[model samples]
Target chain A: MREKTTEPLVRIRGVHKSFGSLEVLKGIDLDVDQGEVCVLLGRSGSGKSTLLRCINHLEGLNDGEIHVGGERIGYERRRDHLLPMTSRQAARQRQNIGMVFQRFNLFAHRTVLENVMEAPIYVAKRPRKEVKREALELLERVGLADKPAAYPAMLSGGQQQRVAIARALAMHPALMLFDEPTSALDPELVGEVLTVIQDLARSGMTMIVVTHEISFAREVADTAVFMDGGLVVEKGPPSEILSDPSDPRTRTFLSRVLKETA
Target chain B: MASATADPIGESSLPIRKRPKLVQWALIAVLGLVVAAGAFSVVNNENFGWPIVFEYFTSPRILSGLVRTLHLTALSMAIGIVLGVILALMHMSRNRFVQSIAWAYIWFFRGTPVFVQLLFWGSISALYPKLILGLPFGGPAWLEMSANDLITPYIAAVLGLGLNEAAYMAEIVRAGIKSVDRGQSEAATALGMPDGLTTRRVVLPQAMRVIIPPTGNQLIGMLKTSSLVAVLAYPELLYSAQLIYAVNYQTIPLLITASLWYLLITSVLSVGQYYLERHFGRSEARSSLEAR
Candidate 1:
């Protein structure tokens, strides 16, 4: 085993993102250690999703640095300055980081197995036989082995999200980000997706999840972070933050969410 | 309640009737007679030259000309589709210079009449007598040829038709690319595919569902527009007919023969376009059927 170190798997320093005049993330800092499951809890428009996007460099940072596995996300670090990497270089950097969106953005034109196998075969240049076999295994893991031939439009929202997760897993990413994975699913379908994610958490994958599921967060997260209006309101163990929160904002937010779910 | 058992729920299901339209039937009858009368008069008229049209319809000269027209259409459309895709990408590009260049190209080509463009290409030697194969701005020429020799009728026709078609095709292609959801490209980007490969493998395939129908229309339109090449005295289908009629003085018959061939090809192409649209729409078709 590699020696445990103080260095985190994902490190963000004073990250700020904005769309024109409206700032989404304002000078945020955080760290996710290796093999940790960190769940971001917040209402809509609270910068949790934007922070996750910045980690994978899906959204560029206006000011700050995000490093995953000791490498900067979308920029090269020169002496005393940071220069943006070329798109090709930035794409290569994204290979190690997997992301699942709220809408479950599976390639609608691709079959389930093809979606899982796409990045491996096309981007990584893996042989078809090898990728296909592994892709089948991934489908089996997601409990979708029987529907490899099905297009995404034929699948339920929960099934599509699972396939999306498998698609991201095909790259064997070092870190995974889930942005409201079950938020779009039907109420009855949410459990299946949460179960899949809980299994992933148990398997020691380094994941940062943004979700409104308080019970799931308390069950799976090593660190539960409450964010509000582009800033982290409170950060601590799930037990402390979920049941007996310190911050008044966190208390208010949690109460509203729990009442809605209840 | 007791009588309902025999009738099985409410008055024999109301007979499932459609209202009769007396005016529609009367209009159809009148239109049919007019069409038949017109057809009979044309068939009876000796000057119409029906037999002459049939004789030259498959004549070797006319057949070869028909082949040339097909070749020109296919080649020009090939150029148009390829260059159209490139220009569409450039027009959508974030770079101001590249985007404006594409805009300028589309504006110039679409602004001018294609007939004038063809004529310009036909006498391009008047504009530039000698053509040089080298760099711009007084650079040394590696090879030189007369413009008349370099720009043959076929080449000129292809260039004129293809370049102009590309301008329209570019707009069609742009609309297609825009129709795709933004999330599709973002998902591809998240999977680590570069923008170019993502476009080819992801965006363009989805865009084809929107791009195919108008492209088919353009193809059919090109079949007829190719007749304009006759102005250059190039012997495509129409010009070939013109050649025969000029000798035999069978103007109407030869022209009729050429029209028949154009109609035939365009009809076939329209059917083909239907099948291509269905092929691209497979997934959506299946899903809609499932929904129904």
Candidate 2:
């Protein structure tokens, strides 16, 4: 695989997030270069999903910084303090960060086409004619070209997730986040959605996918990150982290995951 | 699981169809008895005054009053539902100040009786007889109207009904809003939509599935509540019936006439509301496949 850029596409430095008094992310740090796929692997309550959400700015940081494509997300550094940005400013940062959810939260009331084009036309202020043309092409890319007029409830879970991916891609984000994107799918439906993500990965789309599918992670991830107890236990190339690990917790967790699936 | 369920032999050889239910037969007998009793009473009773009911069914004065009742119900509910939607949004505001303001308004309007509200609006002149339309005190007045002129019987009834109706409808709308999944908003945020556009384009439309049924109930309730305006001397169907019975001393028959008209109007509204509910639920419902 060709490494596209030397500069990091995403940088997390000492990022800490807490819900009320319970700390979820404890002084986490990681980085991803341009056009790299980082798969986050962790047991439940290991802060993998929380860290992913922090990158998306759905959860605010209690400390530290997150930067995507060299720009801080959700907060601005003023002298010595990191101040939370306004909602509008925070939303502007999301334009370059796409997210696919575990349950495929497509807008139920809108047609597949409307769901794809809404953010581009309304938020980006793109011309309607152009957005529609690109949105149709995006739906075509996701293999949903024939069902643009269909509602989300009418589509199967895998199809809905693909439309969600197309919706995020319409903005042409710099980085994409996946929060266990296929965890809620039927076993049969999981493969199609993973295939789409794999395709995106090979084509050099920078993404951070939090998932339990170790095989998919091994197949697509340039880097495998294992997190436990609100900390990154180990992160390295897929070959080292997925098969052999230095940390005791990482080995136990990976073995248990692999055994459960087997 | 599928392989275990497959037919290894003649699985259909001993098919047993559904048997008839005793409950169905009992229900039909009870309903037939009730209908027969009702018919016998209607035919035999003289005080019901069936002849008088038919005589006045299409009478000009009563018909006009019926028209007026329909008009009031339509206009008041139209304004009420619109105000209700705004209040619902305000109630959901993140700003505590705006949310409290919406809460106080809803509490004030819904806490009181609608009849009392109509009476209060009817006699508003006793409190603020003159309303000057200009800047604060001592500023030059641009226009001034006595409260009596503004608070006509019709306007008072509308104000009373619509304002009070708005409070109840606001609750219904809020319940609908709450029923929608939180993930919808989170997903919209993930797509880079600002809060306002996210709510307007995504949340509220999905909330419609929950909001529509209760809102239709509120519409029908508004129609019935419009009768309270009769106490304010408005010439609605009930008031007109009261006026006719006062001279003829046939209060029962007159009220029966008004009741029938209310029924007719509400039945029509029910049909329309049914279609409206179907339209809202259509997005998630498989209408064509379900029908089959």
Judging by lDDT against the true structure, name the best candidate.
1
For candidate 1, lDDT tens digit of each residue in A1-262?
3456769999999999999999998888998999999999988999999999899888888998998999989998889998888889989988899999999988878899999999999999999999999999999998999999998888889999999999999999999999999999999999999999999999999999999999999999999999999998899889999999999999999999999999
Expressed as tens digits, the lDDT of each residue in B173-205 for candidate 2 is 898889889999998998889998888898888
Clashes of 2: 0
Look at candidate 2 and tell me the lDDT of residue B3.
91
List, for all models, the DockQ compared with the true complex.
0.75, 0.53
A187-236 in candidate 2: lDDT tens per residue? 99999999999989988899999999999988899999999989998999
Instruction: Give lDDT for model 2.
Output: 0.90
Return the interface RMSD of model 2: 2.1
Fnat for model 1 comes to 0.58
Compute the lDDT of residue B223 as modeled in candidate 1.
Answer: 88
- Residue A23 local lDDT, model 2: 91
- For each candidate, what is chain B's TM-score? 0.94, 0.89
Question: Over 4 Å off in model 1, which ranges?
Answer: A1-6, B1-24
CA shift at B55, candidate 1, in angstroms? 1.7
